[model samples]
Target: VNRSATEIAEAIDYVGGILSVGAATDLSFVNVLVMRDSFDFAADLLAEIARTPVFEPAEIERQRQQVLSGIQVSLDDPAYLAGVVFGRLVYGLHPYGMPHNGTPASVRSVTRDDLRAFHEVHYVPNNTLLAIVGDIEAEPAFAAAERVFGDWTPRELPVSPNAELPAPTRRVVVVDKPGSAQTAIRVGHLGLARDSSDYLPFDVALKILGGEGGNRIGSVLRTERSLTYAASAEVVSRRFGGDFMAMADTRSDATAEALRLMVDEVARMQRERVSRRELENAQAYLAGSFPLTIEAPNAIAAQVLESLLYGLDLADLPTYPNRINAVTVDEIQRVTRAYLQPRQLSVVLVGEASAFVDDLVGVGFDDVEILSIDEIGPFLTRDDQVVSVDSFSPLLPLVP
Candidate 1:
């Protein structure tokens, strides 16, 4: 078990298996897939890596560099910048407000001892959930898991820290990228958590707003006005909290109009009831696609694990279609009106600020903050301090 990272990779490849580790907002997991004949070997390997990770100094340094390089590349991306700034605007000082990957400064300070302490507290039997799906009998699979993991001692899990997220507010921020032809825009406000009773109806509502079933935002922005090639909205539901966001990219000249229309569509969804036809389209798409999600063994495992992770009823899996179909127009309107705050939406725009700054006030966005692309890092680290107008000598008034 005292093997290098390269040794582990070669062993997995020798057995025709795949091993990967990933972290999310609420959980981290190690997933392994192998042919039936190699189940014992793969399971043992999985246990070794999950329970006894060495956090080798050289491997840690290599991975840290890789993450830093990735962050550097993302810094040059306008869409990434918009999303990061928007998250800060929505979540405030909560962990969700920060970038998932540690910032450049945070990354550089991580020590091997820090990694070991994190692993000691978090990697526990009580905190783990395993899902094994393949051509294997349930009884034997359970037995194999017990044999491999039964000896790992359970420990008391550390209490999770709690932080209050911010309430919705009408704040506008523009990241000035000189000479950029198109503006990347983000809009919306806080939404309900994953386990909220209103999640299904709200999900249906968002789909109609800009998802696969019926995209009112896309129809208006792309098809009708020809403002942009694409636009969409979605509700991201996490364990403790979530957000509802609508996004688009438009030419610099049309930035103000595109943003106005996106906000209007969101308000419209709340004000009026959707037609029977629109409701049916969204329901049918959701109900019809349910089966495809669990068509294969791996797919079925994923769906089952997600249900368990969110504390949903496993018995409800077969009834998913019925529940989706049961959602009515009245329910959609009820949830949207209860949740969507059009007037208080947080907005982010990244592009040539000079081309669109003067127009924002005309479109009803009077109070704004203008930050040069270079200022984003310091802006994110500090609390609500306005960057001085004189900082950017070439730009117009920083705020109107």
Candidate 2:
């Protein structure tokens, strides 16, 4: 949710300031991200957030305006609109389906009081865990923990019950953006949780599919076919099972073909596990790339922090790449059979539906009646209407 460098920097400052000892004191957490081990909260911080957030009205209002403007940007972009349709199709009723940034109605209604209440309920020490890293020592880190986060007495909380996910069914939702120049295509099913036994192999499959352009699926869809600028697949790992997705934006004329090609790619990968050389290249790429990335302060900090959050020891961290390298082709096929076989794959095409609707039906999408922006209202909304991911998660710049 921390979307920009300015926001992230400010957040880090906030964290350091809250915990630092010298004039060089680190700011509090709104600056430094407290990466969680799990979404579960720490009892102390949770209590403070729920009941005692010192929200400056001016700051709250600024954030609200920042959010409001973001909405307008999302509504105007077709690709952004397609993303919303896709997120909804997979996540259904989970908070994952909800916009990460508050909706307009929720945004407008949000008061300092609302945030305070939300923080206490969701941010308590019992509900949170922190992962710390860097040049800091363990003793001072613990002391900093007590100084900045302790003294949070226990309090009663609503037991966070397990969330229920909708039964899987495939259906296509096309959001008609009439006269648009391009079609945004997304295909895939539910994502696996980070802890799932199937996770590592699935990660390998995702890499082979869309992790890069020269890989098998990308080789067929983008390089050979020339239909899409780039087609990519990803398996997102969130608190629960994340949404696995493959997406591309192409000329509206090619929409139907693009969708079918993607569907065929899924069938291709599932039937044929990656070859030994592709697997070796992927492993070598991972092995060669990780150390260089590890050289940076932020990357090192992140690794340490994640370990703290997940409670992994030196042993768990180092063995990770080894596991990725050792994945058998059988593992890939097994995970595919288990998670990728949704009875119905939610197929969504966002443009000129009339031109491609019949083609899509021919390809096997149920064609869940196309929704006008007006119709998608009660189902999901921002104030009275819907906006897209453009508002929440921007297309962050590719690194230089």
Candidate 3:
């Protein structure tokens, strides 16, 4: 039970020497909160995590091992596999699609220096935002902010690379696991970010597409087609433009058919006008769900945080629900036609590849590329090699 300092130091040195690199994981607590005098609250905590802090490699290693174990345990999990594949194909070269769980190769490659460098780039005072809401006034809030972040001096952000959005295009990617029992299917295209004004309308429109019980997507996928247990379309709204994905897990034999029908539904909305009933149902579902979603204090905090981070006005809160309520039937259909395109979408699936790959090629995708988990590892890494980790290595061995 009593180990010598040599034993512990040897363990750290051996492990550190073996891996040769260290990791740093900083999960941004993106607080979206609603409160009185929110801006004042933001000023108060501008440097919450940005200020000088000590690096913790021991913690990082602990976390790294924990995550590694989790991924290994989840290797048998079909749902995780499907989600990872969906992000890969939908985002393509973008940061959003980066492998969330670090690949074994990438983890091995990350040095403690890499994490230190990443912190310099991302964690800074000006880079952070705070939004507080409820039972608070603006004046006192500003005073509090001055007390909290008043001396918050500006600092240069680290020179991280950029992730430019690619023009939407069409393709079909398959994760062909032989002898798999079920098929996990996802179909859709890219959409707006948190800051895009178009985001609000697009979000409401997408909700109508699939979010609530009465909307078009929910009605069609679950009730009409009954293709699988459940199917729904939801936009992946993020700091960067996220994805608009429609997904369902169907029997392997019926996966291709389900995919085709979903595409038709997406196209149908684009081509045709929404009927009066569909409009009313969408409105009712959104408005009814709006207040209901914010009953919790945590959500209130999150909302405040979101508004602050995205540079939104406090007034947007009350007006947001109103905007959803005011969306006309034409607006819903127009947005559907404009944003959701079956032809412009990517078809991603995880299951028996034999069942659907040939049929998918028959549909229109001439460049159907079969990808394995290994082939995509680099694209999914979290930090430094976000663009292409392999590029950092020498070309001699690979080419030879």
| Model number with the top TM-score | 1
Best of the two (1, 3) by lDDT: 1
lDDT of 2 by residue, 149-185 (tens): 6776655666433555555577778888778788888
lDDT, candidate 3, at 359:
74
Cα lDDT of candidate 3 equals 0.62
What's the ranking of the predictions by TM-score, best on top? 1, 2, 3
- Tens-digit lDDT string for candidate 1 (26-125): 6666777788888888778778877888889999999999999998998888898999899889988777777777578778989999878887877777
lDDT of 2: 0.61
TM-score of 1: 0.94
Error of 3 at 294 (Å): 3.1
Best candidate (score: lDDT): 1
**Count of backbone clashes for each model?**
0, 40, 27
